[model samples]
Target: MKTYLPSTSYEYATVQKVAGTTITEASDVLAAEEPLEIRLGYGPAGQRQHRTLSITMRTPGHDFELTAGFLLTEGIIRSRADLTGILYCPDVAKDEERENVVRAELVPGLSLDLPRLERHFYTSSSCGVCGKTSIDAVHATSCPVLPTDGPYLDVAVVHELPARQRAAQALFEQTGGLHAAALFSPAGELLLLREDVGRHNALDKVIGAALLAEWLPLHQHVLLVSGRASFELVQKAAVAGIPIMAAVGAPSSLAVQAATNFGMTLLGFVRQQRYNVYCHGWRLVNQQPAGGPDKVA
Candidate 1:
């Protein structure tokens, strides 16, 4: 853990046999949930400026990436060059809510239109984009055209994703209340995973980690979610240029629509041995026998 300090108490669960059935209850206690305030800085050297952007309810560990990814997806900063540095406020330790505040300093000349960003508040990783007045608005800030020749994954690799995703969810193993988001290579190797009480938070954590590592435009990786594929999750992946997305649960109509619009592959209901390909079925390699002709895999 970050070890800054904790405020509230968290109750980790324990399972018990009640009569004939096995039930779980909170008994062992752990650290509390941490809230982080994201701040942005801009303008000239003599009059450098900073503003409180938003307070996100999250664990304090990945604060930097969270800020970077937030700026990227919001279309505030296109590349890492736009940011000068990301750090906690100097007096954070003196503040009781130290885990609740962090700051990101931007490069000089990076301008932000407050009104435009305010309108974008309705569109975030957690919330779907439905408040648009017209389709033109969606076109204005939609995901950029991805490199069409990104890496490809074999069908067999996708079949193994459910088990891989489940194996990485340590928090979910204990609480059963959290959602997980993971990234895998085209060959089915696990790259990164994060668990959170909110589905969107999990995805954000992954995006933030990638941003911190300067790994935006994650075109070679496939994103996997432990739960249903929501429109917002697909939006985040598209923004990061992840070409393939899979989930162990169902996908909403909007999620499917977003994937189709972005030319990204969306997979859903990916259990142990079976999965439903929502879009871009052509990416799956042929699974035909050696002596047979080309066939759909």
Candidate 2:
């Protein structure tokens, strides 16, 4: 594995600030958005095959973790043992190009279902996969149904997560443009956090870090996102075996359905002193009944 260096997460830009009638030019911090190409190296040892797996626009940091997480969540690779090494593409001529491209080497002769991978990429790129098909695809993967036995979280703890996540968002404080994903214990202690311009990428980085550290199947932890919960985010969390997920913003209808199907607790609008429990509310303690109408069939 090549030495991994941190990439610049923010950039400096000159902006015109308008306050009342006065206008002044000042330096502003902007979150960096760059394209990262993920490559896969597989096949036999002496004769290896390389392919560009994906290219994504993300904040230029935690590229390796992002790559790893993408693979796992996409159902390309199951665990860290499948990856032989991850490194920046050293074959590139320019240093800048090299950093933007990452190569994940798979263990020699590891079986890969190429057609499924291609179909997945094609569906995602073309936006042709319907909601049902997408959900069905997730079920087709090795993602397991979340357990309901334990790791119950307190309502107070859930309420404090947004503030805690906000306070620890160093990059977001600088640019105010980055999204963040954080993992916390049931007692509300922050464990791992990752930030990026894209919400999915941020979650991918967090999952990737945990995957590399052999801390996967995060069934005992709660996941928090700085933005609205999407189906993709819920899918990734479910694949990682996260039992509970909270978002600062509202969740889409599909997100709720997917979470419901997976037996994962989904919380939305987790701010101020309260939040909405979309499904599987049994895992939350100190919670009163919503007393709303019957569930829509």
Per-residue CA lDDT of candidate 1, range 74-104, in tens? Answer: 6787778888899888766566666567788
- In lDDT terms, which candidate is top? 2
Give model 2's TM-score versus the native structure: 0.94
| lDDT accuracy of residue 62 in candidate 1 | 57
lDDT of 2 at 219: 88
Q: lDDT of each structure?
A: 0.75, 0.89
Instruction: Please give each candidate's TM-score.
Output: 0.82, 0.94
lDDT of 2 at 63: 92
Q: Which candidate number maximizes TM-score?
A: 2
